[model samples]
Target: MMAFEFPGQYYEVIRGTLRDVHAETAYLADWLAKSGKATGGRVLDLGCGTGTTLRALAARGHGGVGVDASAAFIAWATEAGGDGLEYVRADLADLDVAEFATEEPFDLVVCLFATLNMVPPEALVPLLRQVRGRLAPGGHLVLDAAHLLGFVDTYQPSMIAHHQRDGVLLTRMVHTSVNGHTACWRNEETILARDPDGAVSMHENGFDQWVLTAPQIRGALAAAGFRVVAEHGGFRDAPPPPFGKGPLVQVAALDG
Candidate 1:
């Protein structure tokens, strides 16, 4: 495994780090609580790592189900589950979560923080469409992806953007190539802390992530039968070039 991939060592460090999951917490709790009038339904957190969002939703008095692909993360989430939360290790690229869909489709489906970038461009359409099918009428779809214009300097893209609490050091490297349909990013990470004290310390150990452009993300969602609702620059109607450290966030609604 390369430094720019989800390496095993990085996972162990992540399990120890990632203390405060406020980002997802804020998104889920706020969105589910005051997403306009009354929808009266639970929420689904896709690619939910450690079931943070799921637990957050539960805290907000809503039933939440978190889904991820990493078994380790899933197990951690499951242990963290219960008390009105459920975490499943299912491939979101191809999932049949009819049971949690409640035979009425989920009221909200979320894919936050460029979770879509991990998947290939080809799989996006089908994935979104499938998710759309599991959404109830008048439900909302909020998916996020990487922002293009946000990072033009590939060589010196960004420094070791550290997730201090998570003991993570993230380094990004953009591919020296681009196209209208596809774009890629290379993320190099390092884990710098561990349990049992000085026994296993890391000067460099972490995972990687590939990002996508705004257009590519939008096109995929539109093709999946979603109506462009409101895509803010950043978290809350920020500004252009809404990616990078800004965490390019997009919130859309699947139309029936």
Candidate 2:
């Protein structure tokens, strides 16, 4: 079993594989509805893994642009998107957001699936502050992050993932004891048989994701000049238990 990291080809794979998960879709829909009422305005999918959330929004009639640090993910997003929906390869921290936002300001900017927790908390401030400046007054910044309770489960030896397109072996063996902020994921992936002749290969990978708590994420948003609007416990139409599995915390805020 090998570990994997994101923001590269692996990000593309994960994004493609997990694009339409039910719980994630539910989360995407919630953010889209709030942002889609802008009558033809733009929405920004920040730290967009592979533009899944952007695609979801475009399907709802909202124009979308996907931005991420991953070159491969951007390439995939570009190839996978339509006219109103496009992907850009840019660091969230370096984008001249004012120039790229088509509708003067973004009605909504969404960063999904614990994307915020992967970064240094301090770095998140400037990045989100830039996003805030690009939002129209009363517009929102919706970021889905792992609830502190998300890691309630004890580590398992491994997990098997098999789909029509691929087969995966995920192992969480390496623990990032660095401030207990990160979880290192080790993975082994192999593409399914797609050629008449042998053309597939298995690849090993490793990556790390720093985890953040709900209070920390909220405070970071606040420090970036945002006003907290609401926080749903998870996407199950019910509040998350104090500590539970796959806990996703949604933070909605307005530019103050």
Candidate 3:
């Protein structure tokens, strides 16, 4: 398990590399609105890296709390926090919701960007159940994972991706394999920095992720007392592709 501890410099390098913030935030805000979980409600962002989503939602007048395993990320988040927003440093799998739920029984719980995949198989269902117990009536749990189809059908030995900006260069390589229902991912990242004095430095880190199939994830939610209300291929509300292909996003509600 590779722990997440992205420093400020790392954040700066990738801040603009990802999707457009306004568009992405609006997309998520719209999803919550359509689900009847928006406005004046409370949101919980599990594995919330730097609390971007939480901050966005908070700015929209919804109270938000973000939790992540990395103290560095949480510190950055806290520094950027205000307006109906809070950041907590804790592992989602190990957190006691009662103690930190500034607003108890959240109206929405989010685990995005394949964050749910980080919870090991034995701990996944328990984590989901814990989330269920922390949701208000009619609350929704929205989560996504890298589809098994991609791992199974589009199998690749290794792939490299790189981004460079502001005198920083980041390169990543990922190697993937599957055994039975578990897909193993090994990822290595190298960061190169150049200072004003022409001094260059390099940093390297690696991590692993074990992913599950869409059906397996749905089943886990079901066993955790959730009813799958919707499923999609990605962030958009489009129909999911055939099994073993594309990402999987599931919106579930607590079962009575």
TM-score of each: 0.73, 0.74, 0.85
lDDT of 1 by residue, 88-179 (tens): 77766676676454554577788865567666666778888888887766667777665554445433544543333343443322223333
Give the per-residue lDDT digits (tens) of candidate 3, residues 45-152.
998888777877888878878888887778888887668888888876687777774546788889987778767677889889889998888778888676655556
Report lDDT (CA) for all predictions. Answer: 0.60, 0.60, 0.74
Residue-pair clashes per prediction, in order, are 3, 12, 2
Misplaced by over 4 Å in model 2 are 1-32, 35-39, 93-103, 152-198, 243-246
TM-score of 2: 0.74
Task: Write the residue-wise lDDT of candidate 2 on 141-200 in tens digits.
Answer: 777776544643533345455433344322222232233433433223433322224345
Best by TM-score: 3
Screening candidate 3 with a backbone cut-off below 3 angstroms (N, C-alpha, C), the clashing residue pairs are 149-244, 149-245
As a whole number from 0 to 100, the lDDT of residue 131 in candidate 1 is 83
Q: Which ten residues in a row have the lowest lDDT in candidate 2?
A: 169-178
2 versus 3: better lDDT goes to = 3
TM-score of 3: 0.85
Candidate 2 vs 3: which has more TM-score: 3
